[model samples]
Target chain A: MISTTNESDPNPNESTLVEASPRRAWYRVDDFLAMGLAALIIVTATVSALLVRPPNIPQLVQDHQTSKVRLQQLDPSAESFSADRKKIIKQQAEIESSIATMPLKGWLVRPGEWKDDPRAAFVKSDKSIATPLLATFGVLLTLFAAVSFVQGQSAWRFALGFCGVFGLALFSYVLAGQEVVKHYNLEYALWAVLLGLLISNTIGTPKWLSQATRTEFYIKTGLVLLGAEVLFNKLLALGLPGVFVAWVVTPIVLVSTYLFGQYVLRIPSKSLNMVISADMSVCGVSAAVATAAACRAKKEELSLAIGLSLIFTVAMMVVQPFIVRASGMGEVIGGAWMGGTIDSTGAVAAAGELVGSVAKDVAATVKMIQNILIGVIAFAVAIYWVSFVEPRDDGSKPSVMEIWHRFPKFTLGFLLVSLILSVIQSQGIEGKSLVSSIVDGTTKSVREWMFCLAFVSIGLESNFREYRKMLASGKPVILYVCGQTLNLILSFLMAWLMFSKVFPNAASELLAK
Target chain B: MRFINTGVLKFACACAVVVAVWMLVLPVVGDFPSVRQRIEGNRAAGINPTAVFYTDHPAMADIERSIAAKVNAPTGSFWQFSARRPK
Candidate 1:
């Protein structure tokens, strides 16, 4: 017996040792860095929002995300179409009552009345401003150190690099706050991307910064938190009609778009085609990222998709309000159409607000319903890729474990949070409001910061040279334009049918309520 | 051209035909009288919604004034307008 105990001999003892070794407090560096940092942010934000009771400041009409110009475009009766006035009165009363419960109303930021309902009446106090900055700095420092440790590098160097990068992003956010920028829907995402591009193109990204330039890590973390915001109960607000428009029409458009890109456009990369299709058909940049990862698309493809999305989003945000006004479509139809077509949630909300209060509410709800499709779409794409697209060359199918290993696990995190929140919300308003407060107050802010950081990373890591190469053939652009055009037509048709014919009562019911 | 095999070409042609047909058919299906009536109803209302000036909320008014002041604050507006706009 020549070394019977050796692993080659398949000895039981050796096998046990081999299996146990990997289980012995072992973790992959990259995985640990991303997961640990993300977990830290999620935990801190959720806990902080719950524990730190900021004065129960009522939301102001002025704080509404819709611009004055867009609101002006709404039908005069839009203010009366739904319970806009009643809601405003009720909110004011609630705000006043909550203030009475507070020990001191003077020190707290007052919820100023909207001279006009749904408009901001006061300059929001900067009481919470310092808190966000301090929190951001602390979180950023810890995240950088952790990532550096995982990469087995100098922690302080990476931390310093992160600070500089984050400072750039912060400056972009400040610029985005300018009234003109807000008016034009030039959001911080766009500014962050521009800033990153400016640095990477001109001064060039420094080497040390590469340690913190993790686009996927930041995006995945944000996506997980974003999942928490996609409360399932919100989808039922539009009832069966919404389900038909958002759920049924969306898959049809998505499948057709992918096929169009693959067969008609003959895109060289299937993953690129898939990414473009998903981005166009579903919720734009977010859908594209999820789908790209599901189908294992390249970083370059995701960047291209996001760039196209932002360009179109800005155009849509500015133009769609006018279209809604000109077409004289009721708020329900306009909102649903905009919700389904617009890529970004914030952009959709902004466009809807431009349409009017009713449209804004409908658009936001429809977008939320559509947003939930990400989970299903990601799972389907991953399964399809594993089974058909990337079948083994040897004709052997992958094992379940193999496919599971390749699956984007962050999606699971997203689903878990959504389920937990959905269940909590189903109980009653108390549970619902609790979840909303935590998500809106804390997690959402953190998520936005992460998203901004992700875009910056996308910019820093992306080379214009590579992007040009991807766009050289013009196939991707053609794919996006054609697919989006199809999406616009299909979603509009479905919305009209569902809201106007199949469920006119549902639409009216929403207005009446 | 190298990747454009017979099957892919056929698939593409089929998809093109399907898209064409759908494009032709969608408007007809979507142009229900009910939808048109709703839109027309809104148009016929003869009232164009205007922006709320928030005259009641002086604070809100103040906020707007501040934002306007910030945006319209002239660093070199005259020079920039002449150079950029060339009016």
Candidate 2:
């Protein structure tokens, strides 16, 4: 049976049956174990990235520089200038290709895209993904079973349960890999949650399978791993104009939306309100997950927020570009607007591309800069919850010690990993390439699996009754609509001001590159 | 017969619906000319419209590199020179 030995929950049945309150102590044994494993993975990725040196990157950079000089010396109208430019482009591609990726690139594969045939996801061009899938299953089962053993649960039972959970997650990936689903950016998280919900709400989650549905553990670890990808150097992608458009406008929208939900809309669940607010205002699913954890939101609330975001993301992805073109909004401004407003990065890119290439670059860059807010927002929300929200709700002022105890310790791991990686990336081009390789090769795939598993666990844990309760007031939908409207107006204003009025040359300058 | 409970039948139906939508409905939607054009255009530009993060989009690497080079370039460099308009 699923159980926990944590002192906070003495009742074994309670541990298995009920979700723990967000008020539990910050440093549980399971949390520490998750953080420990995450740190180990980060360290492994880093060491591997540094050790696997690309050959003669410096020489390639020199060659590109020489070609650049030659192109510059030629007259602008000269035919040779165009030829030299093409050479420079080819040289740049070589430099990008030379960057060393993680050693486990092929071993950590997920399902590939498939059209018409489901089997194509697993096998393409005689290359079967069975080995990698089996390898992943084995590794995850062993690691999680070890965690169960450390927690004083039956590791054998946990292993048995893990196979079921892993299978569901694998199926979720295949469903998400459908070419049409992938085209619309219907990510695996949505599928994982839906599949889990279908099983749970229909036949109900079996007690045996419940043993391996450690949602919090998986999510915390994934968030920590996510920190490695949030390099601070990305904040400078569009320089000051990008920063003003993303960093400045985002907090205003987030805070304004939250306040509106609280005062005007009078949303009953502040945590739900915050999660929805963050999800709509910041970068979609990632933001919702972080905020939900930080504020200790109910699982149902997180699911609801994600559901709303995904629906809107699809609609916005299709409609926003049409509006941009119709309005005669310049590509840079339109791209920035979409990047700041759209919750998902992929949808933002797709929407921006519908406008123009210049728009796509600006949109993606704005979103990347905005993505860094997850760490800051999570940390702030955690502190706010512990300091004000908890005390007000409980009618007991938490002492400074109590506040510290209530704080989610996992946020610290997330910030620390981001800080360490950002410092590494800030070193030079080699450092940047190394960080990219680590993220692309190892951490990203692992983090995605963790999130998928967490979503599945959430679905298995959730009930229709809880969702009914969440939606009874109709406030979440209203809150999302109101918040998204605010986001659109504010983001468009900021984008226009930054990319047009404030830095009129920035758009044209970006386009030239 | 008793084993095929309401819940089990409902679950089976949900699975069938999911399969049908993925296999049938979505392909038709994707085949629309406007949708096809946008999808093709994005592919040509190396943009993954469904990318969840910046790193997931392969084009981002080139964009990031170009931005970094521009931001870190020396005074009067080729990057700056390229951005200038002809008189």
Candidate 3:
């Protein structure tokens, strides 16, 4: 009987009850504490309808497991590019066609005239004061927990990472508390300035949270949340012109900027190069996260890339309105240009508002349309990198399958969520109360988990010691400046063509003055 | 061999514990309340994008409508659906 029972026996599969490595700790005491905390959060949220969210566990699991299918067929070469492009175009055309049917008034909010539209004037009478003190409480708690637990090579790592989180969390809280969620903040530039000054003082930032452990969790959870956000119904809101504009602009921005980064600027680091390229090409912070995950970019690289994207994103947000107005572009034109040009959606919306009426709608609509390109772009890049870039190296290159295996497991989950959203949206389940609840829940889980993980990862990977040695400042900073200039120029040009020439609600004059 | 396997299992167990504490569980607990508040804040903002500034003031309605028109435009998402093409 012992001889008959070989190593090939399937009994172990049944008896062992193998759990995935990352998830296995759910049975532990620390994990139990974490869950106890999570459940308390849910209970608090459930007590308030305003904080309502649906379930996201299923969505998270699905996104990770779903990518094996996409991976199996994803060998995108120059030859395959033709068919792929056609399929993508056809698919896009179909989505746009359906979007054209929405009664134009549903998502609409008439901005300029007070007497005409019936919504709040961007702020309500019950205006509340800033909640910085509470946010400070949250930040200090995080810092104490982190600094006391995780030690680095020196004191500065402990200081900077903790301070960085405290500062960023406070800023982020304030932004979200306001009218629009400003995804990128101007304060990051100030952080860079401060860090540069103190980095030499070398207060290293390794605290309790390990960077690799956090990145692994943050990326996956982020993917699931990203999936929920990329619902099909949302895409259908961007009409024909919106579709045409996004199609024309997004890829052009990505490819051209990547080339500029490589040839003109001659950036050396592959990790930095890829991330900057993705950030330029897509929806800034989100794109950086996805691309960083796909490429297995180091935690520091992801953090730096995001920090750069945030800085530039704010620059565009602040400067774009003045430029559009100064350039003598009309409201619609200015809006389109600003919207198409800026990297972050929140910043784009803010810039558009600064211009006046027509520009606000056009800019926001255009940005929203372009934002839909995120999933398609991420998938296309992942496939292309694994299949074409890897294979081109011949014997020295990693196998495509190996590349696939090495690919982030979480993107699969992200795509699956997209597919499920697409299917449900296709079946007319969108806009319903239940679906809305689900999306709310899914997105909530994503933001809560992902942001914390990203912060923790940022803390872990970055320290005063390594950051001081690694930062070679001259060329990369210059490239960032140059790329930013190109973004402004091209975005304004597109705005001119679309708003002034095509749709021109033509507030061009009152605004231009 | 048995001792080695047990050691390996123990190490795996420890990593799993720490990872879960760091990623899934801790994050959900710490920030979920703030996140919930943000979501409601977003919806309260969403229900009337213009409402962030003025209360029931008459000027707000026009501003809200304008914001709605801009945000809710029939923009294409990813794969466009046929037959509903925007005029």
Number of the top lDDT candidate? 2
Error of 3 at A347 (Å): 1.5
lDDT of 3 by residue, A41-152 (tens): 3233223422332345345334423432332243433467335533533443333233222221121111121111112222233332223333433433453344223322
Clashing pairs in 2: none
Please report the TM-score between candidate 3 and the true structure.
0.56
Worst 10 residues of 2 chain B by lDDT: B74-83
Q: Could you say which candidate leads in DockQ?
A: 2
Better of 2 and 3 by DockQ: 2
Residues B11-76, model 3: lDDT tens digits: 566457744643455435434664445334423332222111111122222332333333332331
Query: In model 2, what is the error at residue A478, expressed in angstroms?
Result: 1.3
Give model 3's docking category.
incorrect
Predicted model 1 interface RMSD: 23.1
Identify the superior model by lDDT, candidate 1 or candidate 3: 1
Give the lDDT of residue A342 in candidate 3: 70
lDDT tens per residue, model 2, A1-513: 243323322232321211333443334365577788888777777788667766677886676567556544655456574465546656765665576557876677788777677889998558998998788778677777787776666787778778888889999989988767877878888999999999998887887777778888888888888889887867877877788888998999899999999999998889989999999999999999989988888778888898999999999998999999999988888998999999998889888888887788788889999999888999999899888987545697879987877778788889998999899888755676678778888888888888888889888888888888878888999988988998899889988876666656566656554
| Residue runs of model 1 more than 4 Å from their true location after superposition | A1-26, A29-40, A45-131, A391-395, A511-513, B1-87
Candidate 1: residue pairs that collide: A61-A118, A61-A119, A61-A120, A62-A119, A62-A120, A121-B60
What's the C-alpha lDDT at position A285 in model 3? 64
When summed lDDT is taken over every stretch of 10 residues in candidate 1 chain A, the lowest stretch is A12-21
